[model samples]
Target: MNIPDIWRGLTRSRLFWPVLTLVALAILNVVVAPNFFSIQVKDGHLFGSIIDILRNGAPTILVALGMTLVIATRGIDLSVGAIVAISGALACTIIADAPDGNNPGTVVFAVAVSLVFSLVLGSWNGLLVSVFGIQPIIATLILMTAGRGIAMLITEGQIITVSSAPYKVIGAGYWFGLPASIVIAGIMFAIAALFTRRTALGLLIESVGINPEASRLAGIRSRGIIWTVYVFSAVCAAIAGLMISSNVTAADANSAGLYIEMDAILAVVIGGTSLAGGRYSLTGSLIGAFVIQTLTTTVYTIGIAPEITLVFKALVVIAVCLLQSPVVQARMHRRKAAPPLPPVPSGTITTPVAAETAGVAS
Candidate 1:
């Protein structure tokens, strides 16, 4: 392809700008801290700032992955944060009360119960939106508001801590020379990508997102598709909850996964998925999650005030959103393509009277 063609392709690619932003951030990080990208092996496991970012970012990545699918179907799950809290609360509460919380069987049982509860919560959301015709935001908001209270009740308004070594391994341990959380996130992404692409699921979701009525008329079970996505999103949130609670070995109902939904949504937007719905990219969302984590780390490395770190995040998000905006892009194109005013003859520069008369005629 010619230079202009290649340029156009690069500009049009959805992943291009986010990727560019991520690379820029990484470069800045390296500049600020020379060892930013350095990974070292200790006890047969990889450890480094970059590795920690991936491991810590894993939960957000998981949530964003599911959010991509839900957004692609013109839906949002505001309750994900609450679901995360509930998952952690339930599991930790269960494990804490067990005679031997560290037993593999106890941990497994607690995990199973948490997942099942999450599925039920997901079904509740699906029923409201798909069957009751409620708006996605409002429907999920119900749980968002109520879920924390439920979690508090589950833990009796106390933080539930556990001593399960097996459970701790899930979020804090290493596997195959990598963080287990990172491994889990990678596996989840792979599964989602393969499941949607290898089947007709992805197309159906896009169709529903583009136009639910049209998809229904076209013989697609749009309701079922929509319902399934909500459930899927919940499961993703539950798994993230496990990772989060595992990391700390405690479940604080009031604060676990707080404001996480916002981050997940932001990641989805940064990844090129529209709030309006339709197409999505899991890969982009994964990268967006890492971008967010890296930004947070960079803030700390630069010694920025913790309170003002959010302002930096806000600025970066605004920049990304503006860069992706079609209106901004179109205006830029117009400015570039507009011709410079024709050069007037230097010796015959118009007098004020002549210039005023020409302007009036125009």
Candidate 2:
């Protein structure tokens, strides 16, 4: 109803700090580059740094969205990056080997095969975690370690290139005056949000994350939920792989989606989703994805040395995490709520000892 109330409400929200950090990054970029926020229409499409950020960050956002759910169930998927590589490798390999790679039918078949492979990989991860009771990290690590090798085999230890016009549309094309990747990411985010929020699945996930044994006792089907999340995560990664490979029109088994799992995990953490599991936020992940992409752009825009870029990014992430920490927030709130020291009598100098004595007396 008033300023303090509104401020309090905002501070309590999970999205508050992430949104603030994104705005701060944007402001920093605009300060460095006057045209950072400028968007121009060209050939019926938007072109600008902002759009580029959205387009570039779309894959990470998709991965983070799925990772949010996986993490919500007290699980992690280190194999997502590998899945990304495998998906792209398989698709490109198939298309390159096809009789007519540019045909829509060939592209569709390749995509279907890639998606199906992703589903199998996801199921394997789920089986390890849900059925065998393996630790989530360990289960996914198995795939993470071997996934690239598998991809290499699929691509015959080389990069697979294709010339499918329809395939390129997935990553490099435009639709409705926006990047197609952005549209796809938006669709996936909306589907995830509605699927979880509109149904009882979200509550079940939180319940499982908070206490898996208790959830099982209450008949929450914890195993099924866990398995489903991993599958969904792999599928999301697969789609991201498609976009990445399609953008370049090639899939390099060794490099396709390299280290992307780290970025996705960082995005989820920055977006206010605890790696410890339980409640999550998709919108926060979206903002956090943009934050990461924008930060990367900032590094280039400001001309940071190549060797130091990673260190700089790490430092910024650390700062944001510290600011979002509960202890820091508590301290900040306490400081804000604490009454200001009664202004010292005008022009009166108080010795440190006298100030301490006065404070103790009060």
Candidate 3:
């Protein structure tokens, strides 16, 4: 019934605009592009731009899933990127030192060690935020600043080349005609989804996010949950690091997982999670990751300078965020939320006979 209300409703609809945007982008690609949907097999390998996105973006999606949980509790893990760097370095060091054709044990040993360190790092961040009352950003920032340095120290400032097939399989191997990263990401997503669904952790996270004081007063161990999520985020980063190293058959401490946590944060935001906390949607985050990767591929294919993608994507995300904000949503809901007109003044009701008489007279 009102212009402002209609406009706000349009902006606030979570599914409507995000879906429309995705469709519009696809349409644009189809119209102004060459075979955007076509897949090709060449040299005993499958090739497609879409497949490339699925392969390359899976790790980001996986990391973003963990980030979504962390942010759902109004927390951030700035050290995820660093964890990736360190994990890759750890893996490569083992493989590099292993004798020729003796990589199986080394790979397992390295993964175990890397996971242990990630767990500790995550626990440290969690303890700082939970027990010491440090802000999530501040706590993780301390690690972020030191993590890369630690990674470099692990690698001795040199990129370590690893020629292990098992390690490489994480990045380059295929299963069911898809990249291994895709499969691993899928498994992680399913497990996360199941854990959150089957347990009360999801509700606990939301309660803490919505009202931490209330959750604590209700006897919930909010701090423990917070700690668990930070550790989970570190584990995700480590897995991503392995995928990165496996793809290239080498680990570069300085380059692997560089600025990836930023990408993951952007993804969580784009997926409709409030930065202020209380709710999260992993499916949406997965979609957001795909959207990001699609844009990257499109930029490369369209001959647009790769550097422009950061600016372009940033602007697009900003626009989406503004549209998804409470201001816009509240405005949109007004028309729907307004009370229906009163049937008639209680004393002004007319009988059916009177209605018939009035009709006859008319």
Please provide TM-scores, in order, for all candidate models, with all chains considered together: 0.92, 0.91, 0.87
The sequence of per-residue lDDT tens digits that candidate 2 reaches over residues 1-362 is 98877887788777887788888888888889989989999999999999999998989998998899999998999999999999999999888888888899989998899989999999999999999999999999999999999999998898788888999999999999999999999999999999899999989999999999999999889999999999999999999999999999999989888888988888888889988889888888888888888889899988899889889889888988887899987876663456778877874748988778778988
- lDDT of model 3, residue 256: 86
* Better by lDDT, candidate 3 or 2: 2
lDDT of each: 0.92, 0.90, 0.83
Tens digit per residue, CA lDDT, model 3, 1-362:
68876766566655555555566666667766768878887665567866787899987987898899999999998999999999999888877877762467777888889889999999999999989999999999999989999999989999999788877878888877778899999999998888887789888988888888899999999999899999899999999988988899877888888888888998888788888889788877887777777767666766777768888778777877776787866664655557787688764628998778878988
Which number leads on TM-score?
1
User: Candidate 2, which segments miss by more than 4 Å at Cα?
Assistant: 1-6, 335-362
lDDT tens digits, residues 97-118, model 1?
9999879999999999999999
Q: How far is candidate 1 from the true structure (C-alpha RMSD, Å)?
A: 7.0
Query: Best candidate per lDDT, number?
Result: 1
Error of 3 at 352 (Å): 20
Q: Native-vs-model 2 lDDT?
A: 0.90
Error of 1 at 162 (Å): 0.9
Minimal lDDT window, size 10, model 1: 329-338
Ranking by TM-score: 1, 2, 3
What is the total number of backbone clashes in candidate 1? 0
Give the clash count for each candidate: 0, 0, 2
